[model samples]
Target: MRLLALDRFTWRRIYWILLVFLVILITVWWQPNRTFPTGGSLARDSANPQQVKGAIQPIPLSVDLDVEKVALGEELFRDKRLSADNQVSCLSCHHFKRGGADRQTYSVGSGGVPGDINALTVFNAGFNFRFNWNGAYETLEDQIQATLQNPKAMGSQWNEVVEELQATPEYPKLFARAYADGLTAENIKDAIATYIKSLYTPNSRFDQYLKGDEQALTPDEKAGYQLFQDYGCISCHQGMNIGGNMFQRFGVIGDYFDPKDGITQADLGYYNVTKDEADRYVFRVPSLRNVALTAPYMHNGSVETLEEMVKIVAKAQLGRTLSEGDTDLIVQFLKTLTGEYLGGSLEKLALDSDDDITS
Candidate 1:
């Protein structure tokens, strides 16, 4: 009798398990349309650009640079006094010699704290639509202010920043030459922004080819360019900088966030700022200028190699995987996008010292 009761209890438990599975199956089956991006719920092709229909026009390198403002801006760009610890400067992470990025997975900021996102290259950042991956700041001034205060970044309060700069004997004169009112926060931001504005790059091999110099790019690069457009990378990345004009989800046709990485809050990209459901997982498309130099790509600094980046982009963004040869050709094509600054050097501006500034 005890053995019979034991078997009956086990059968009851089995029945309950089956019932629960059926309920779950019904719930999931009813929500068939709610599958992930690659499952066809979201507009993958809409997010992946196909052509450079309208891109921001590239500025000619021959155009005269504003030397005074650029010089003053260059001083501030390298000034560590702008930060609280007198260590971190704009150049600390965005190294010009390294293609505007420190090439690390994450950059060390003030007090040795690390930034969550990788720094974008300053080479052609001026042409981007919105600043930062989240599109937080609209202008360069706003971005500067945010960077100065963010504890995970420069960590200096705005007032403290101004006070430190004010105490410096060399900044006022530089500010005076750059702006109508010298050394004020507004003018300080303006000068820095002006300097960054002057950091535009042009005269890349791609630009030469675009201007009708067919021989500028090699055969492999030309093939890569064709694949780049044919596979639809040009749609979003078409602009002068080859991107930065719009926002896109990191994975257009897939959920890029791997739960196995212990990820909790779905990287709710621009949606965090906009509070719109559709904006979820969206980030500002970064410029590919000097892409060959920038390593540890993406906002999270997840991907390390450019070749792997290309593969991921091809599969997730383009809804297809590229052949090894195609990827190699595409990489070759991307290499030609590196541009030259007309009259300035990123290395010089980044490594400038406080003693170099004029009062």
Candidate 2:
């Protein structure tokens, strides 16, 4: 009887050990891998094993980049010589203080020509899986090339831009410092792209909440976040940039474009690139970071306010009519997403003359 009791106790101990091992394995597997641009891993919360993980992840506090390249890039970004008319620069549409985008419905390009679609924010653009409203370019380099050649945009030939920059005394020295093979077209693009990559805004209130701060969000904001998930907004708008990781049909539940208003070529979306009928009206989901500050939303920029955009998107995308109270809550939650850039709040740093465009 003594031997049998001892055997039973040993078996019970083995069973408990196996169960504990399984729990640890599952927890590790379930945890999402959060990595910084510099390839560093973010720390996990091991103490609260029971804490539920959300789909959205926080942006890294900082990125590792060459300061010289960043400076050169910034100089190139603001230089008007890249344009055919010498009146427009990258900053013409992508204003740093205006949420990295202009308040204009359709950004004016070279010679005051209006673009077909709205300009997406340059801030946190590095996190996007694809670039532009149509996901036309996979890399920023490719997009920059297209922009340089676009008649309505920069409207300058690569050869012309190279010649113009090479003639400049300051650019030659800047290029020499930033690149080994300096004053080349490729090097110029690389410098500008690197500078744009450094524009990530982190440490938003929502990010603080994600990093284990229980009081970072108010009760109403928490409820709004819950509603955001419940209403399936989290479906396409998941991951680090909140929405830039995937592409989805703008009108998932119903046709968004009105027959009376007529559909333009821009409304065709990715279909214009692939000529695929199935891809019609499909667009890359834009990042919601600093969304409150970037107004006149959507591809055509028809919607002027965040409130109206939310109402239209919920009905058109999810096929659900959100109550006024719920909409207010969601908007409040979105407001918390405005992050800090250069250790200052984007709200405070925004340009007072958001609508005025000198270029």
Residues 322-357 of candidate 2 have per-residue lDDT tens digits of 899999999998988999888899988784654555
Query: What would the per-residue lDDT of candidate 1 be over residues 58-146, giving only the tens digit for each residue?
Result: 54675355788778878888888777788888888776767777777778888898667777888777877788877878999999888
Q: Which 10 residues in a row give candidate 2 its minimum summed lDDT?
A: 35-44
TM-score of 2: 0.84
Could you estimate the TM-score for every candidate?
A: 0.79, 0.84
Q: What residue runs in model 2 are displaced by over 4 Å at the alpha carbon?
A: 1-52, 351-359
**Top candidate, metric lDDT:** 2
**Which candidate gets the maximum TM-score versus the true structure?**
2
Q: What C-alpha RMSD separates each model from the true structure?
A: 15.0, 8.0
lDDT (0 to 1) per candidate: 0.75, 0.84
